[model samples]
Target: MTITLYNTATRSKQPLEPIEDGKVSMYVCGPTVYDRAHIGNARAVVVFDMLYRLLRHEYGAESVTYVRNFTDVDDKINARAAEEGRPISEITEETTQWFLDDMAAIGALEPNEMPRATAYVPHMVKMIEGLIEKGHAYAAEGHVLFKVRSYADYGKLSGRSVDDMIAGARVEVAPYKEDPMDFVLWKPSDADTPGWDSPWGRGRPGWHIECSAMAYELLGERFDIHGGGNDLTFPHHENEIAQSKCAGHDFANIWMHNEMLQVEGKKMSKSLGNFFTVRDLLDQGVPGEVIRFVMLSTHYRKPMDWTEQKRVEAEKTLVGWYWMTEDAATGEVPAALIDALRSDLNVSKALMEMHLMAKNGDAAGLLSSMTLLGFPAVNQNLSPSLLEKVQRTNAAPDMLDSNSDLQLFQKKLESLRADALVSKDFSALDDLKGKLGAAGVEVRMTKEGVTLSPGPFFAIENLEVLK
Candidate 1:
């Protein structure tokens, strides 16, 4: 089956025919690494992750190359470092790790290449020098600016004219720029800021140029797909087009943009008090799988509303599915689900298909589809005892009760663990652990023995059958 995507550049849905047979390349704008990744940031990461998974499924996993860049050197990071009285490197390194941890928690696969802007400074300088040599860029007052007028299709991607952009867009009106539409390739940095020695002086690459130079160095001038949030459609992506094209590169073949995320039908803002980091939700006991599901419940191209209602519903649905498929080995993904995903990456429709599978008791199919959807069973690779300990800690209570019913359930879990150790098959043990989590009971399986206790969300009614 052919994969199709809604290309923001051409304004149409088109088949994803890779430029090279049996090979696919992708580049997505990554986080700035100034702070923790917000839910909005996770949406873009997960959206591209889904696409990467689908591409790897269509074309062999080894055939696909995905690159997501990190803007480690930026004004935001500089300000954060100054405010905290920390080294710029310290701030970037910590924040970059936070972003990776947060995204991994939400089940986003690490891209093949994560280029930090600072690492590619020399490449950026070389690209800027090439642009200057080609008359596409000019240096003024120790700053290098791309001549927007030099590229004829400057506003083609965002569907805006240069005149319209100058009038409507909040462009920087620097006296050094020949035109208001012209954007910086490199800018002089003060002694206090992170800077690199270049022909223009000790400076840093501008925001837009960092991506272009990094993408060129990693994925080359032409790649199959380029993606980011729609908010970047205008100046960020448009400038990338002007700079990359004027330097005689075809750049990205297809441009994909996921819609922005909102919280409870309103724009998420710190002022509005709805702003949330991915870590925020995690700390509130929202599982990473639940977050990923809620994000994909809506089509990628549509605005996603992260409401409490959606979160609760997604959690319930995932719990139910996890329980139903606990003992089933992953089977082949259903054709219908694949079809849904293939059609412009219609994740909503694909999820609906999974619901149908769950309705019909297609446990193996459901598990397989869920895995493809990035919801693999919890800790399937861990030892049965280790897996039980993890589920126990999820909503663990400080105290454990030695009631008769709890004792009997603990004995049964021990028996299951004993059989699993010999057979080296954990399906039955995993199934029981699923029930424990579903019933809100903390399950502890250690070298000494198994223990049962009521957890934070414990419901005795759900655990009575185990007694």
Candidate 2:
């Protein structure tokens, strides 16, 4: 099977031709681990995870190497540690586990290698030294900075001239630097900050250099794909390419960047009140499967918007799918699904095919397709235990108990719905639905039946009015 991806470096969709046939290498930028991963971070993780699954499917699982690095050492981590009055190690350790747990909850497969930035400090220092030797970098005042002008093709990835970049970008202005366009390779760490002894001084590696070093050490000089959010395409990735190429390393061949995410058509920010972490949503009784479904509904190249309506629809759809495949036998995956994914990770199209399969009552085919798409379907051949775990996690918190009053309300709603269908009037049914929603009971009505489950804000006392 051939896989074509839109390469950020080349600005075109190119077929993935690995340097070594049948062997694919992928590296995606992981989290900084200073706090819980927000929705935007989860988007990048899920996007690359979809690609990882596709690569494993096309190339044998053993033939693929996926590396995602953790930025254990950063200014943000230090600031958090200082604010909490805790050790840096403790902060990094706790937040790192938080990242792993949250990502796992969303069905993201772990990369083959998760190198820590601190673990690869020596490699970063060595690379910096080589850049200095090659005249691409220089040391001043115990700091090493990459000379942006030293590389002629500095802005090729971003497609901007030096003057334009300097004018448009947020280039740090330091008195020790030779030029404003130059980026830091190594910076001096103070006594209170984390530092490693290097040729320049007791300093730490810069953020951009850490990835370049880790990718080279793990995936070698050349690799197939390098991925991250599009926000990094500017100074971060541009700097990585300049230093890596100057050191005579081929580096990554294909660059894939997923678009940023928004919440309800607005940028997610703490000030906007829509900003939330993955843990926040999960804690609020939103199923991980539902979150993944909403994310994959949009194309990776396009911006994804998270809204309450999408969440409700996703939960309803998944409930129906689970019911359909409950008694299904394992079957072959649909070829059309693979075709959609192969065409530049067209997950939206693949989701459409699954919807069609569900519509046609192809239970076995739907089950297999859902499993391949990372849903927790019953994979009798592989992991039967997954179904049980998913069922437990997907259950809403404070699920409605089938008591006499609740049952009466359910029956009344069913009768009202039937009456409304026959009389062609829905005001009464709509009012009852609104009441149930206010009580935090999710009312799902299908041709077969109606189901009421507790939502995140479920309050049993609120049901007294219904009685």
Candidate 3:
């Protein structure tokens, strides 16, 4: 299947044709290791991870080259170290591992190569010297700045003109800068700070230079796809393009950027009192799988809003799916399922297809599709006894007292629901439902019947009165 992706560079959906027939290469801008990855960051993590999986699906697994960099040498890391009275290496190393653990919890695949910025300092220096030689950059007071206007297409990725950018006034105007729009490529570092000796002087590479250098070093001059959050489309990606193209490298052919995430219909901000980290949600007992499901519920190109309602729905759906596929062996993922994912990571559509498969009693198909979507798969078909034991563990403990007790509660609730429909007086029904809800049992009412799926807080003893 020819995988089609939405390219921010072209502003169009284009089919991916790898430079090498069977090999695929992709570079995603990874995190700067200073703090825990927030939900906003998780969106980009899952987005590129989905693309990485899809690329491997279309191209053979071994033929794919995925590189995600670790920005270990950022000012934020330095500041965090100084503020906490710890070594900068300790901060970067700890936060980098935290990033990996959290993303892995949410089902992100590790990239084929994870190169740290500190390791690529020499490569960055070489690239900067070339940019200087090509007249795309210049040295000013021990600092190297990219000549933005020197490359006519500097703002092409962000679709902003240089004149407009200058008029807008976001550029950092420094006495060392020849133009307000000139961005730093290399900045001087003192003895106290992390420093590398270079042609310019003792200095470190700029933020934008890290990805450009790492991508070139790992994936070569040109690669298949480059991805990150929409926030990076501007100065970050735009500068990377200018410098890479100016250095005479082909660079990434397809530029893909996922839109930013939101919380409850608003931009997640600490000032707004809605900021949350991935670890926070996990600590609150939301399964990592559920978080991954909620992320996929919305299309990658659209802004995903994380809500409590979505979390509950995801939990309910996943529990049902896991139970349904308990004894099923792995089957081939449906072709239609793959088509939905291939069409620009249309995850919501793929989710719909998986639901249809489940409803049709295609347990094997359902399991396969879930795994393809990055959900965990059961390595072996679970035995009936083991499945029941697992279900009891997740269900409210009080309700699973005995077989007779289980039947009694289900029969009682089913009777109450039936009466509530006919009497049109759901006062009793509502009360029982509320009681069940309190015990961590979700009450789903359909035209055909009432279904009770135990939630994380379920308790069986609460239903003793029904007996």
Candidate 4:
């Protein structure tokens, strides 16, 4: 089945047909390097990371080219530099590194290309010059602004009229603007501000222009998909669409946006005393995989209510899945789960199906299925030392034996069986039955019929009666 994505531009789930056969070019808006990325910001990263993983899994890894850009030369970064009394470059570098570290800790894969606005200044200048030459943009005073009226399709992406944008924009209307709707393509930098000498002036590119330039330079004019948080749907992405289309390029074919993340039913903010960084979540003992599971529990386009209970629930669910597959003697996952993932990355549905498979005693099928969902069953490769530690912590006195190998294997198997029960996998019961029977164990199928015991291994006494 072909993969379908919810395109923000069309407001529909469209089939993801690549421009070039077997290859997909995707760009996700990256963080502005001024402060640590909060959990809201991390949601976008994780959402896109999942998309990237899904795409790579469906297509070959080499077929996907992912680009996420850093807005290093933004007003926010400049303000941060001033606040800290440091050079803007230094501040940008420091903050960018911190952002990378935070994202990595949460298991986000590095993009194929990570471009910084500071490194793409020349490209931005060329694009601005092209816009000016095409009469799509103009230079006024020490600033250059894109003429909103010039692009009749300005509101196509954002659905916001130029008049509405101008009225709502909180920034003071500069006297040099030809129209209030005209957004800055370039602006003059003062002696202390970071700037690059261009045909317009010694100033930096505007926030919107930087993305347009970087995207064009890296992915060409018409790419497959451009993605980011829903908050960027307005002026930012709208401006990019206008600038790129007017620059005589087709630009992106699909625009995908993930919804905002809220904390405890409220918008995550410092004033609410609920603002959280990914680091904060980690420091609070939230597992990285748990964070990922929680983020993916809801569809990407739906706003996620991140509460502590939700996180705890996600962890419990993940631990259960791990336990089910970890116990199979053959250690094979079910194929049904893998098939579910191939259908549209329906992770929630896949998980539900896994429960059904477990109930049906499909151990191999369950293991195979969960593996396709990127949840591999635990195996013997767990470090011996770690296993020893686990044994020391959780082993019952009766479970200890002088033989290290037997003790470790038995303990691991028992833990796996316990986990399977917790995950509601009844297939594990049969495995336990077989193992106990082979070890000369006798099982009485009593009125309750829920327990097993060791008896004469080779004796087949009252087999029919036991059933």
The Cα local distance difference test for each model comes to 0.84, 0.85, 0.83, 0.73
What are the per-residue Cα lDDT tens digits for candidate 3 across 384-435? 3333444865543221233344445567778987887799888987887777
TM-score to true structure, per model: 0.82, 0.82, 0.83, 0.77
* Candidate 3: regions farther than 4 A off: 378-390, 393-467
Q: Write the per-residue lDDT of candidate 2 for residues 329-419, one digit (tens) a residue.
A: 8688899999999999999888867766764567888898887788876443222333443366444322123244466788999999999
Candidate 1 structure quality by residue, lDDT tens digits, 362-464: 8889889988988867555322332343355444321212244566788888999999999999999999898887765678878898877654234334565
Comparing 1 and 3 on lDDT, the stronger one: 1
Ranking by lDDT: 2, 1, 3, 4
* Worst window of 10 by summed lDDT in candidate 2: 395-404
- Candidate with the larger lDDT of 2 and 4: 2
After superposition, candidate 1 runs with Cα above 4 Å error: 381-467
Q: List ranges where model 4 is wrong by over 4 Å.
A: 166-171, 327-345, 354-467
Candidate 1 weakest lDDT stretch, 10 residues: 394-403
**Model 2 lDDT, residue 5, Cα:** 96
The candidate, 2 or 3, that scores higher on TM-score is 3
* Cα lDDT tens digits for candidate 4, 62-169: 999999999988788878888889988788888889889877766677999999988999998999898999999999988999998999998888777777776777
